[model samples]
Every structure is written in structure tokens, then in C-alpha cells.
Target chain A: MKKWKRSARLVDMTQQLLREPHRLIPLSDFAERYQAAKSSISEDLAIVHEVFQQEGSGFVETVSGAAGGVRYIPRAGWERSRETALRLCRELENPSRILPGGYLFLSDLLGDVSLVREIGLIWASFFHDREVDAVVTVETKGIPLAYATASYLGVPVVIIRRDSRITEGSVVTINTVSGSSKRLGSLSLSRRSLQEGARVLVIDDFMKAGGTVRGMIDLMSEFRAEVVGVGVMAETLTEERLVEESASLATVTDIDVKQNRIAVQLGSLFR
Target chain B: MKKWKRSARLVDMTQQLLREPHRLIPLSDFAERYQAAKSSISEDLAIVHEVFQQEGSGFVETVSGAAGGVRYIPRAGWERSRETALRLCRELENPSRILPGGYLFLSDLLGDVSLVREIGLIWASFFHDREVDAVVTVETKGIPLAYATASYLGVPVVIIRRDSRITEGSVVTINTVSGSSKRLGSLSLSRRSLQEGARVLVIDDFMKAGGTVRGMIDLMSEFRAEVVGVGVMAETLTEERLVEESASLATVTDIDVKQNRIAVQLGSLFR
Candidate 1:
């Protein structure tokens, strides 16, 4: 292998770290890849680390000891997260997003890779210290967010399904009702998806009365797992709250379907 | 904006490009962000681009017109993709993964963030140049792959659910058959999910008889969309292939439930 210059090394290291976020890479690995001294690799990492912090990109932590190495933790400052959240709110406040029912048209938002990714990084910034073993979400809308968060956390995503299939082996299913609508629904998870006593961070695209969130929490209990945190992209400002301990990036305080008008606010992440 | 050095600028630029793949970025934006000359930004981009290609990460497109800048397109070389596919097959070949009905347990692979992201990149590399408007997939198991590919393509993902809901307004549903089992199923897509005449790329986790992929192809036609391409993570080796215009990463040529053995080969991607 040819010795890599600092510029090329910086770019390559950044790609590798970003590709596998939250993974520890020993300095020796970089030294071997670049055919450079450990000291030089360390200097390159410092430059990358400083720029990452200044840009509110993420965190780079160095671990000492025989099994020690450096890892990239996806992070965004509270201020930057709040700004992203507010911008998300503004983008969603358009009247055209108001559907026939009280629900908002957010598939586009959930489909926005950049927005979903930023939300993931911001949520990761808040929960990186929680020691989460996995990120969880129900099937459908929440899958993308869960995957994004898991990518940043370097963990797997356990999806709760509406219906259990034979391909996943035996599953644990729970019946619950929507906290606001009283609509009965069931969520299922494969038995092998998470280990017992695993600390899980629950995520979703939207929370209304937090019924689905509550269902996932209830389902996790069946596996003897601990819920470390709950993150949602948007939560409605409803008085009837089923899940209390949760965070959201944006909130819809008012949605007038009759008039095709909607109001959005950045969630408690800003506060 | 602060004037960033080549080292710091390279790190930041790589992050920005990787954050949103397949989206064209204007060079002026980078110049403004770093408060540096366009020439300097180009130099930084060249380093980033070279590293990306050398690392088999993705494509760094430089558009020359005034509206042109540079963008990243996630790509994996055939050798790397085949290796990934073979690894995926080995992971699935476990005897314990054999379900009661001979269906392979694959949710674990789908849940794996690194694996799923790599498969997404591999598939994106094949379909990115097709000018796809969006990546489409059926509900349930296919959502993750759809989202991953959509992320790399910088396009939205359109999920076709088994049942229609009021939340997404009016939807178009179609009844289809499982090409292998001959079971009837219905899939629905939101009217707003895709625009007319969209060139869509369809993706899925597994294709037994390509029934679900066929359903998505039918659904796309409802929107007057063209099926630009189809990609599956794995396809069963069968004498009869319902969908011919498709690509797969891996193939299961044999499965022995009685003896608890299975065989998986790198799909035709190598050929």
C-alpha cells in the first residue's frame, strides 16, 4: 500500500468513520492503512475531530488501554438541533400538508433523507450516553427514523410489526388501543430481535396520544427489556398523553383539516 | 463562516457529501461555507473524490455548468458487493434460520445497520444512473431496504401497504397473487406518493416468486410511472422466475430442512 498524504488520509478516515458510526477504530488500523506513524494519524484525527465539533457534526472519543481505540459518536449541538427542529417545523407547517382527517401528510418529511438523518444525529446527540443496545420502532412510517438512529448508534433496529409473519420465527404480540382514538391495534416483535434486559431506545415518526409508543413499551416488557428513551420526529399537542417520558423534534399544536391549515412548533429538544 | 484549512475543509466537505448522497451540490455553497476560493474548494473536493473512489465508497460527480457543483453517489464495486452478498448468504445459511415452512429467517440481516446500508449502496451503484424518481417497495419487510436505497439516491421511498388508511388521504389499491403460493393479497399506495410519469426503481428484501415486486410494478403503473429497474437483496434460485428484469445480490440454490443444511451462492451479480 502506498503511504497516504494527510489530505487523502483525512478524507478516507472521515468516510470510514461516517460509514460505521459509533464504531471504535484503533490508531494502529489507521497507521497501517496510511502507512504513517501513530503520531501522524493522531494529528489527522485531531483535525477531523475539531472540525466535526465546530460543525456540530459529531463527537470523536479516544479510549486508552490495550483494547482501546477511537470512535465516532453522531452528535449535534442543542442549539443546532433546535434550529434543525424549527426548520423542520416550518417546512411542515404548510397548509397543503393537512390531510382530510386530523392527520398531517408527513410521508414526504419522513422520506427526506437529509431531514431524517439530521433528526437522527440530533436525537443521537441527546441519547448517545444512554447505553442503548438497540433502536426500536413500529413497521411502516417509523422504520426509516429507527434505521437512521441505529446507523448513528452502530446498533441494530428492531421493528415492531403490525402483523407477525412465519419468517421471523415465533414472535411476541401485544394488543393495545390508540390513546386518543381508542382504535385497537396490535404490535409484534420477533423473539430474537432483542436480548433480555437489553436497554432500548424507542423511536417513531409521529406520536398521537402516544398509543403506538405505549404499545412498543408494553411489547418490550414481554421480553424483559428496559426502555431507555423514546424519540419521535413529531408529537401532537394533545391533552391525552399515553406515553410521558419521550422527546420529539417537532410538534403539531393545531391542525384544522376543515380549513386546510396547520401549526407546527419545535418540540422540547429546543427547550 | 470561517476560513477553513484544507485538512478541516476536506473533513467537513466529506461529511456534507456523505450526509445526502445523489444530491447535486453547488461549489459556490462550499466556497461560501469555508469562506475560501472556488479553486481551493475544488482542490479539497478533488482529494475527497479521490479517496471516495479509492475506498469503493461512491461517486463524486462534478457538474461543470453554473448550476453545477459536486455530489456523491454511493457505489460499491462488483467484487466488494459480491463479497458482501456472499457474507449475507453465509449468515443466512444457519440451520436455525430454517423456519417451519422452509422460509429463511432474514429479519436479523435486515435489522443490521451496516449490512443493510452496504446492500443499499451496492444496489444504488447499479441503479443510480437510471434517473429514478423514487425507490418503491412493499410494506413490512421491504421498507428498510427501500429507505436505504432512497437515502443513497436522495429520493423519497414509496411504501405500498397491504391495507389502505385514511391518514394518507385517497390511495390506489390493487389485488395481486403470490407467484409462488398463489395466495391473493392487496397492496395500496398513497396517491400523493409519486408524481405522474415517475421513473421508479423497485427494491425488496427477498423475492420468492417476485409477487410483491410484481405488485409494486403494477402499483407504479397506476401512477403512470415507469419501472426503471428492480433490485432485490436476495432471490431464490427457481426454474421459473416471475420477474426477469431484476438484479439480486444473493441466491439460495438449495435448502435441506430434514438435515438442517442450506446452500447460498453469490447471485448473478458476479456474472
Candidate 2:
């Protein structure tokens, strides 16, 4: 292997660390890859860590021991998180998002990959130290957010399906009722999707009375998985809240279909 | 702002470039952020570009002019792509994945975030130059893959629902028949999800007779969106094929339910 310059090593190291957040890379691996001394690699890591800390992007955590390695822990700074939450509130406040039956058209916002990633970063930052084994969510709208958060946290995503499909093989199905509309629904998870006793972080695009989230928590019990934390991109203000504790980035305070108006505010995360 | 050291600047620049792939950043922006001269930034970018090119990860593309800037275009090396495809084939060949009805259980593999990201990188490398405006996929299993590919391409994801929901507002629905099973289904896309005449790349987790992909392409027509490309994580071998051109990472050539065996091979992407 050719010797790598310090500048080239720094760029490559930063790229690798950012690419696989929460993954540990041994110092020997870097030393071998760059054909450089361990001392040199340490110096390079310090520079990278300093830059990340200053930018509030994330930090490189070092584990000193035979089985220890360095891992990147991604974080959204308080200012950045607040900015994202405010931006989400503004986006949710658009009158054009108002739909029939008081439902907001959120596909556009959910479809925005950049925004989804930003929100995922915020959730990951909040739950980074929770030792989350997997990020879970119900299928369709929440899959992107779940995947994004899982990516940042270096965990797999276990999706609960609305209807059990043949492709999922054997699944555990549970009946659910919407808290706001009282609509009956079924949530299913593949038997093989999650391991028993694994810690999971729940993520969703929206929460109305927290019915779906509550159902997810109930289903997680079947797998013997622990719900380390729960997060939603946005939650509506409702009189009936099924889930007792959860975090949200934005709140829909009021939506009047007749008046074509919607009121939005920062979620509990900011508060 | 404090003046950034060259090493710190390089690390920060690499992180920003990797975080926002395909987003062009003006040299002046970096100059202002780092309190450094454009000449220094240019020198740093050259080093970043060289490392990326040599590693086959990607290159920093420079658009020289008043309106032109630099952007990171991520690319998976051919060797890496082949390795990922082969690994996927091996994973698919597990006998335990064989379901009673010959449907292979893939939820576990699809739930793996790192593997999904690797596959996404390969797809992005293949379609990065096609100028994909949005990634489109039918709801359920494909949502994660669509989001992953869209994230790599720096584009939004437009999900095509199996059944139009009230939350989608007004949707364009198209009836489709499963080319293999001869089952009828409806594919719906939100009218607001995509723009007229937008270039789209279709992504899915699996393709069997290509019915879903075909339906997605037809639905794109209603939005006047051009189907720039189509990709699937896996495809099944069948006598009847509906789609003419598509890429897959792995192909299940045969499935024996009685014997609980599955024969998997590299998809067209490797060939």
C-alpha cells in the first residue's frame, strides 16, 4: 500500500466516519489502511474530532482498550435542532396543506429527503445514548423517517405493516383503533424482524392522539423488545392521548378546513 | 468566525460534501465560513478530490464560472458493487427464507440499514448522471429502498400507494394487473407529490414480473413525469416478463418450497 499524505488521510477519515455514524473503527485499521504510524493516526483523529466538535456536527468517541475502537456519534446542535423544528412548524402552517376532513397533506413534506434526514438527525441526537438496538415504525409514511434515524444511529429498521403480507412470512398481528377517528386497523410485524429483548427507538411521521404509536408499543411487547424512546416528526393537539410519553418535533395546534387555516408550533423537543 | 486551520477545513469540507451529495457549494461560501482565501480552499478541494478519485468513492466535481461551484458526486467502485451484489445473492439463498407459498422472506434483509445503504450507493452510482428529480416507488416494502436511493441521489421520494388514502388528498389512480399472478390492483400517486414533466427514477425492493414497476411507470405518465431509470434490489426469474429494461442486484432463479431451497444469482447489474 502506498503511504497516504496527512491531508488525504484527514479527508478520507472524515468521509468514513460520517458515512457510518455510530460504527467503531479500530486505530489499527486506519494505521494499516494508510500505512502510517498509530501516533500519526491519533493526531489526525484529534483534528477531525476538533472540527466536528466546533461545528457541532458530532464527535468521535474513543474507547481505549484491546477491544475498543473509535465511533462517530452524530448530534444536532441545540440551535440547529431549534431551527429545524421552527422550519417544520412553518412548513406545517401552510394553508394549502389543509385537506378534506381536517387531514393535512403531509406527503410533500415527508417526501423531502433532506428534511427527513434533518429530522432523523435530531431524533438520533436525542436517543443516541439510549442503546437503541433497532428503530421501529409502521409502514408507508414512517418508513423513511425510521430508516433515516436508523442510519444515523447505526441500527436496523423493523417496520410494522398495516396488513400482513405473504412476503413477511409468519407475523404477529394486533388490532388497533384510531384515537381520533375510532377507525379500526391492524398492525403486524414479521416474526423475524426483531430479536427478543432488543432495545428499540420508535419513529413516525405523524401522531394523532398517539394511536398508531401506542399500538406500536404494544406490538413491541410481543417481541420482548424494550421501547427505549419514541419520537414523531409532528403530533396533533388532541384531547385524547393514548401514549403517555413521547417526543415530537412539531405540533399541529388547530386546523380548520372550512376556514382553510392551520396553526402549528414547535413540539415538545424544543420546550 | 474564527480562521480555520487547513486540516480542520479539510475535515469540515469533506463532511459537508458527503452530507449533501450533488449540492453545489460556491467557493466563496467556504471562503467566508472558514475565513480563508479561495486559493486555499481550492488547494484543499484538490486534495479531497484526489483521495476520493483514488479510493473510487467519488469525486468533487467543479463547475468553473461565475454561477458554477463544486459538488460531491458519490460513486461505488465496480469491485464494491460486485461484492455487494454477490453478498446479497448469498443472503437470499438461505433456505430459511423460503416461505410456504414459495415467497421468500426478505423483511429481515430489507430491515438491515447498512446493507440498504450499500445497495442505494450502487443504484445512485448507476443513475447519478441521469438527473433524477424524484424517486418513485409503490407503497409497502419499496418505501425504504426508494428513500435510500433518493437520499444518495439528493432527491425527494414520491410513494405510490396501493390504495389511495384520504390523507393523500387528490390522487391519480391507475389499475394494474399482476403480470405473473393475474391479480388486479390499483396504484395511486398524490397529485401534489410530483411535478409535471419531472424526471424520475423508480426503485423497489423486489420485482416479480415487474407488475409494480410497470404500474409505477404508467402512473408517472399521469403526472407527465419522465421515467429516467428503474432499479430493484432483487428480481425473480419467470417466463413472463413485463418490463423491458431494469436493473437488479440479485435474482432468484429458482425456489423449491417442498425442498426448502432457493437458487440465487447476481442480477443484471453485475453482468
Candidate 3:
């Protein structure tokens, strides 16, 4: 193949490989399909894999054994991750993010880029070693941080939609209460979204009463999936609903939105 | 340096480069800091750049001029992107996402993995060439979709808080009438969060009257940032007043909650 066509084919192959990541493809298959030598196909895969890793968008794992091939792992890189779940406890020392009636201003920080990046990077850094296949989160706010973590980890993100639809093909639905609005809401996951035995990292923008976390825990249980870890952008020390298995970037002690005065204790996230 | 340490250092350097992607860096500087040869540093950077591009996260540009170095350009890759976007438009045609007052039932799709992935990929494809630095959206539902697109493009996401906070450091506030509620509400962006001249991709879950999008547009202008593109999970085509340069995956014609029926039209994106 000529150079430009070869380059175009490389783009097509990269796209196809990314479409079905983590799935095995034999070198012989590529050689026959593209009418190219196995060595040339290998070179093309290397170029695509190198570009992806450099961007921190995904990972390429090549198996050298008899039945081995390249597998794409979508990763949420460090800069985009919320890595310091413990440090969040320190940031929670601040009187702010704590609102009257146990509400938290965490939605504010979750909306912040630098703060969420630090938090996401810290959380992803810890999960880098675990065989986490995907990151999951409830609808609305958690989606942002979840997407960030998923990108860094090079894994696809699965969001549990609050409403059901026929177009999803088939789904498992559950009723649960969210901590933020203190309202009962339904969560649904498509039957095909997650594979059984897949290790999942649960993340959220904030945890007040932990009701939503419990709901997610229940949701994951329905799929028979293991929850490897849980990370939050910020958590309230006031309620201990969530266990040590979960981590947070910032912690909130108090918030008096009525008085418009808030206090935040510095966390050890940057350190 | 040893292999593991060298990999860790490369990861650190990649993170640092991502933080200031617009700035170019010389291989000599990285080599000197790491006490490595220029050739080794170049090899490391090649790996980094490859990873970034393959994942559709970002890019590394080699400047051959007198004052040139490697620069990272955040861009999205087109693996399953067009297919995903087209699928989302088909799914949006489902009547389920429709709600009363011409509202669309997008909250569910925003939470779905396949749906979110397709939506994100589509949005990223549109802004891939615009050099979007951040994704912006209003509070609540829009956060998830915004995060997804931002993740694919490897850009930081800045969320506009519905409520203001002192801990946000300092914020620039704006007021606009939302098409949904039609009530005047205030949206705020932290001064430090957004940079001037940065191209932003605006994403939202649904658009009813275009009030919130207008508010977001006003908020972006307040920061002197550019609106590279706008995307929505669903749009109420019956409602006038769309934010001029916006796009939507699905269009809602009607929502009859009482009759248990919704009317929808698909494929309004890229228009």
C-alpha cells in the first residue's frame, strides 16, 4: 500500500480496534483483511497504541502468548482523576460545603475543574493497580467526576439512568433515595451495559446521607458485579453512612447557607 | 533510571504537560530535569504523544521552526463516533424522553452508558477541530453529558454553579430567563476557573425554551471565552429561541404525560 493509503488504513484500523477494545484480534486476520504483511500490521498497531497512551485516553495491552492479542483499556489518566479521597476529609474540616438541613455545596466544587482534576487524579492513581473494568455513577452530578475518572483509567463509564426507556433494549430498574435532594428516585441500567464479574469503581460528586451510594450498591448487586472501590469528590463527616471502603477528596464539616457563611478545613489532597 | 521509575516519571511529566497543554516544551528541558539523554526523552515523549492521540484525548505537535517544540493539542478521535451519534439520534426518536410542557425525557439517556458514550463521541467529533479547552453546562442533568464529551476530548470541564459560594474564591454571576421554568435564575462561574480566549463546548441534557443555554452563553461571554460548539441530548423543536449556534441529538415535538405518550423527531445534530 502507498504511504497515504497506508496512513488512512491505519486510521481505519485504529477506529475499528477502539470500537471493540479488549477483544482479541489475530495478526493473521489483519494480514489477510488488509492484504498486508503481519509485520506491517504490527507496526500500524504500535503507532495507534503509542498515540493513544500519549494522550492518556486509553491503554493497549498486547498478549504475546499463543492466544494473545491487543486489548484496549479506556483509562482515566492522573490529571483528570480525583485521587485523594482521604484528603477530602481534611477539606471537609472547612465549615462550608455544609448547608442547612444537611445539604452540601459539593456540587460547586464538583463543577470546578482544578479541584475535580486533583480529586479525580488522586482517586484514579489508587485504582490504577486494581483490575477495574469500568467506573459507575448515578445520574446528574456524579456523571462529571465519573467521566473524568473513567477517561483517566481508560475504561468506559456506565451511568445508571434515573428513568427507563424501551430503546435501551432490556434493563434492570430499581427504586432508591438520593442523598442530595432527599427524594426517592428510580435508577436503571441496561442489561447489556455491564458484563458479569466486571470490577467497577463507583464515584460520586458528593455524599451527604449516603443514600445514593447505598442505592448504587444495590444497583451493582443486581448485576452481580463486584464494587472494587468507591470515591467521592467531597463527603460530610457528619454522617458515617458510607464505610472506609469509600474515599473522598474533600470533607465538609458545616455550612450555614442561611447565614451565607461557610467554613472549609484544608485537606491534604495536593500533598 | 530504572524501568518502573522511568515509567512513573513519564506519567508525571505527561500530567504536567496536560496541565499546560497550550505551552510548548523543549526535549532538552525535560531531559535535563530527568537527567536523561535527549534521545531517551524524545522516545518518552513519542510514547506519551501516541497514547494521547490514539485515545482521542489530545495531540503532540512538532514545531520545526526556529522556536518550536512539542505542543499538545486536545482533540477527539473518531472511533465509533459517527456511529454512536447516529444511534443516539435514533434512540432520541423514542417517545419516552418526552415530558410535560414540551420537555424531553433525556435524564434517562444521559445516565445510560451506550447512550452517553454515543452522545459524548458525537459532541467530541464536532468540536475536535475547534480546540475546545473546556466543556460548560448548567447544573444538574447537563453535568453528565458535559463530562462525557470533555473526557473524550481530554479537556477540563467547567460547570456553572446554580448557587454562589464564598469558597469558590470569587465568582462572576449572570442572570437570564430559562425556557423551561421561564423564571429568572442566576448562574455563576468562578473567575479563576475559566481562562480568557479558551474555546468552550456547551452541553446540556435538554433544552425547553433556551433560557438556560442563553444564561450559559451570557456566562461564557462574561469570562471573554469563546463558545466553540453546543450540544444537547434532546431539544424541544417546538420551542423557539434556541441558542443560535447550538445542536441537539433529538428533537421533542410533544409530551403527553397524562396520555402516556411522547412525540419525538430525530437527527437534528450537525445542523
Candidate 4:
């Protein structure tokens, strides 16, 4: 049997096992189907489990007793992952998305967790291969998506509030030029919220000029944390110097509010 | 064996199965442990699966093979159901929850899905013994909770937007007063969103004057949709007009914006 064919079969088997977890399969079954030895099948299962877990999806537990086989107890499923990113791209493409006073229309996207979950999965997928310790997003709108992504990654989400809240405890404050309107705004993170040397994944609902992203970068610098990657549900592609490396679920290229029609370009997502 | 003892054992086994979804067990093992016949075990399993599914909590899928056993998938565990209502009460208990205009500060609860999911589940539990075809909420805050509740019941969520959007196609508009402000607000729903004779679960993030709930009732009357129940994350308990029958996660007794504190009482939610 060809090596690529074996890998393809492995992928197929992995997906099947994921959908229906905890069922034990006899070794003879796979040996007959793949024309592989019991040892070979076991090796393939190990690889499949590793890839899935590394992707932050979940675990494939193997039971070794006579009744035991391999099962995928997914903490998160591929259905949730792929759908989340695709929906973000779709909503970001909307044209009325452009707001006066340099605000962006994200209430629709933030309101939809199905959309946020997919976007979170896509972002997590990008960093699935990368090492990241935590996710950060500004409070209010971005909290839902950030929380969704962190939940998928099995990490805690830290919100950067616009103002100090009694619940958040003490905080560190930073001032940065607004990427959208180019005005000054204060950004905040609770003290003890982030740990030192942690690789932080920054996420938000929208990025106009990347000012908020830049503010997060500054905050990370203040905490001595590492910026692993940046992700946004929607971004104005026209902006510059805001993000060194980033992913946008959708790109808003044109907005004609007078016509109440928005033009959007759907980018690569959810595949 | 006594009937009550057997029922208690069934509940325990049901919970255990729900906690571990992928692990299959043979009926003979359970039958031997309980000193009961296979027929009795089968009957118990049927009732267990039925109640679990009806609660919208999780499920039990049975395998018919000789070696096969029942598996529990803790998809949405009971802890999630209880914690949600508890958390909402905690947030609502804050004195700062009171607004000067007799409004309750429910924006925080509306944006959180975990909390919303719990609130939705509590609502679903009440309607579990009842029937609901859809969930209705006025845009934009109520939409998220409505979606969460609808997801729990496996029903559709119909949004009554303050302003009609062309994307939703033709809509039926009705003018009604908001509860807190006692000010009039328009509720509009797409004509295709709901069907006549459908029973609806009305959900909102906060309630003050009971006007929005009344407005929703009026809108339901227009479509001949039955108001199966009205639920709010928080409410001003002082309101006189009860809006017929309703449930609230939390109740606001007073607000001292001067002290930046709000006082609220927990309502009988899941009860």
C-alpha cells in the first residue's frame, strides 16, 4: 500500500472515530480493511490522536482491556470549528458594517456565538500548530468571541476593559492612539490577569485602524508577555501598521451607507 | 427489590451514564449487579433516555450488539443548567443593578452565552412539561438569550427588531411601550418568522415597566401565536403590571447610582 493512501485512510478513520466515540473495534477488523498489522494500526491511531489533541480539539482515549479500543471524546468538534470562521467572514463582508465616527458594525457578529465559535476555531486552528498560552480581548463586544476561542483552546480568556470595573479588581492602564479615528483612548487590563512570558493570542470583533490591537500589543509589552498571533472577525484591509501578523474572517472593502448596501469580500475561512 | 429503591438506582445509573457518554456497558453486567432481569433493565434505560432528552440536558444512545452497552455524553451537563441560574442571581443581586429610569442592568447578562444558556435551560425546564414552538425577543439585547433558549428547546428564535431590516423581507410592525421607561417602542417581526397557532416563549434581558412583555404579548396576538411563557434575566420587582405570567432570574429592589451599587433579589427561576 502507498504511504499517502495509508495517511488518507488514517484521516478518514480519525474523523469517523471522532463522530462516534467510545466504541471498541477489533484489531482483526482494521487488519483486514487496511491490510496492516495490529502494530501498524496502533501506530496510526497514535498519530491521529496526537494531531487531534495538538489542534486543541480533544483527546482520543484508548482502552487496552479485551473489551477496549480507541475512542475520541471530543472537547470540541470540527463542525463547531469550521462553521465559526466561515460565519465571521460572511458577516464582516456586509457593507453597512461601516459606521460614522469611525465605528464598525459588529453587534450582529458578536451577537452570534455560532459565528464567534467558528471564527474562534479558525483562529485557534491557525495557532493550533503554534504555542499560545492565553487569549486577550477588550471587554464588552470582544469578550464573547475571546471567551469562545479560549474555551475551545481550553484556556482562560482575559478581558481588557475600557474602564475599571469593581469586579475586575486592580488594573494596569495604557494610552494609545486610536487606529480608527487617530484619537487617544485608554485601554485596561486587570492586574494579575496576565502572567509573564505567556504567549498571548489577541482577539477582537473588529479592527478599523488596528488601534485596539496596537493597544493590546502595548499592554502585552507592559506585562512582559509574548504576542503569539492576532485575530479579528472583521478588518478594514486598508489599515496599515496596526498588525504585524493577523487573520481576518472577513474584509470590509466598501461601505455605501447612503445606499444602505455594503460590499464585502469573503476570504479564506472554515476549510 | 422495592420500587423506590429501583427508581433511585435508575437515577444514579442514568447520571453516571450521562457523565461518561462513550463508555459502553453490557446489560448483563447491570442486570447482575441489580439482581434484576434484562427486561427490567431495558425498561429503565428507556425511561432514562426519555427524561434526559426531554430535559434538553443530554442523551443516552444504546448499542444493540451483544458486547455493546449504553454510553453517556455529557454534552451539556446538569451542572451547566444549575450554575447558569445561580450566576444570574449573583449578578442580579448587585445593588448597582438598578437604573435611574427604573431599568435593570441586564446588559451584562444578555451578552454572556454560558449564563444565557443556563437561563434558557431553566426556562426550557419549566416549559419541558409544557409546549413551545418558538422563542421571541425584541432586538438587540434579547436576541442572544432568545437564540440560546431556542437552541435548548431545538426550536427557532424569532427576533422583533426595533427597526425592520430589508434582509428579513416583509415584517409585521406593532407599537408597544417599554416596561422600564414606560416609553413606546416598535416591535417588528418578519412575516415568515412565525406561524399562526405556534406557541412562543418570550425572553428579554431585563424588564422594568412590563411594557415590552405586554408588547410581545400583543405581537403574539397579531400572529395568533400563544405566549407559552415570558422570561427575563432581571426585573424590577416593584413593577405593578405583572404582564400576566412571567419568570425572572433576578429581581431588582433598589438602585443607588450615587453609591454605584444596585440591590436585587433572586427570583424563583427554575422552580
lDDT of 2: 0.91
TM-score of chain A as modeled in candidate 2: 0.98
Model 2 has a DockQ score of 0.88
Q: Could you give the candidate ranking by TM-score, starting with the highest? A: 2, 1, 3, 4
Classified by CAPRI criteria, candidate 3 counts as incorrect
The runs of at least 3 residues in candidate 1 whose Cα sits more than 4 Å from the true structure, single-residue gaps closed, are none
Model 2 / residue A147 / CA error / Å: 0.5
Interface RMSD of each: 1.2, 0.8, 7.9, 12.3
DockQ of each candidate's interface versus the true one?
0.80, 0.88, 0.15, 0.05
Model 3 chain B worst lDDT window (10 residues): B1-10
lDDT by residue (A1-271, candidate 2, tens digit) is 8999999999999988988998899999999999999999999999999989888888999999998888899998898889989999999999999888889899988889889989999999999889999999997899989999999999899999999998888999999999989999999998989999999999998999988999999999999999999999999988889998899999999998888899999999888
Question: Top TM-score: which candidate number?
Answer: 2
- Candidate 3 lDDT, tens digit per residue, A156-201? 7777776764434467999987554567878888777789988999
Question: Model 3: what is its DockQ?
Answer: 0.15
Go through the candidates in order and give the clash count of each: 0, 0, 60, 18
Top-scoring candidate (lDDT): 2
